[model samples]
Target: SAVISQKPSRDICQRGTSLTIQCQVDSQVTMMFWYRQQPGQSLTLIATANQGSEATYESGFVIDKFPISRPNLTFSTLTVSNMSPEDSSIYLCSVHGQDQETQYFGPGTRLLVL
Candidate 1:
């Protein structure tokens, strides 16, 4: 099992500003995924950050807008660039467990762009 944690549990940012959220895990993990959960909506896969490789983003999410960094096996960061009001959402960090089937999520970083 991996213990995951995210920085700045919550934040309020101005439109056009960018915020970088950090995710740290207690143990090394192979696959780390980023997700966004909008108000009253289900989680949407944002991207997957694999250590030593570029992050693979899902449909509708561009690297330019959502840059991800996987500096090591136990750490990753997701930056929301040029944020707008519509970008207000709860961002989560998840890592695959030992079995690779189960995933553990971190306390999300909530962002509200005004």
Candidate 2:
């Protein structure tokens, strides 16, 4: 079993602002996934965090918009570079499950960019 933790459970930010969310895991994982869940939409994978290498981002995401950092095996961070009301969503950090390879998510950082 793998356990993950996220900081800033919820935050309300002003427009044109940005926030950085952190994720920490109890064990080393091969790949850590970051997701953004907008209201009423399915989970969208933002990127895959690979240790010692650059993060692999999804099609709609760009490095300048969402910069990811995985400095070590057990830790990583995601920064939302720009702010907008549209950026308001639930940002989650997850790890692959040990047995089934299913991804397990964090409690989520609820962001509201006003």
Candidate 3:
């Protein structure tokens, strides 16, 4: 099992700015992922953060827009750059559990860009 926590549970940002959301896991995890949940929509994977390596972004998502950092097994940060009203959503951090299949997610950071 893995417990995940995220910072800035909710925030209101201005357009053209950025926000960084932190993720911390209770234990080391092999895989960590960042996702975005738009209003009334399912989660969309932003990227896969790999420790000691550059993060792998998903299709239509770029590193410049959603940069990720995995400093170690249990810590990571995802930055949403150049914010816009369309970017308003709930950003989530998740980690693969000890079972390596099940994933645990942080509460999420809700951002509203105006």
Q: Estimate each model's TM-score.
A: 0.98, 0.95, 0.97
- Top TM-score model: 1
Error of 3 at 62 (Å): 0.1
Off by over 4 Å in 2: none
Which residue pairs clash within candidate 1?
none
> Which of candidates 1 and 3 reaches a greater TM-score?
1
Q: What TM-score would candidate 3 get against the native?
A: 0.97
lDDT of 3 by residue, 20-83 (tens): 9999998887779999999999999999998999998899999899988888988999999999
In model 3, the number of clashes is 0
After TM-score superposition, what is the CA distance of residue 17 in candidate 2 from its true location, in Å? Answer: 1.6
Q: For candidate 1, which ten residues in a row score worst on lDDT? A: 95-104
Question: Comparing candidate 1 with candidate 3, which one achieves the higher lDDT?
Answer: 1
Candidate 1: list runs displaced more than 4 Å: none
Ranking by lDDT: 1, 3, 2
* lDDT tens per residue, model 2, 4-38: 89998999999877799999999988789999999
Distance (Å) between predicted and true CA of 73, model 1?
A: 0.7
lDDT per residue for candidate 1 within 4-68, as digits (tens), equals 99998999999999999999999999889999999999999999999999999999999999999
Please tell me which predicted candidate would have the highest lDDT against the true structure. Answer: 1
Backbone atom clashes (below 3 Å) for every candidate: 0, 0, 0
Q: Judge candidate 3 against the unseen true structure and give its global Cα lDDT, from 0 to 1.
A: 0.92
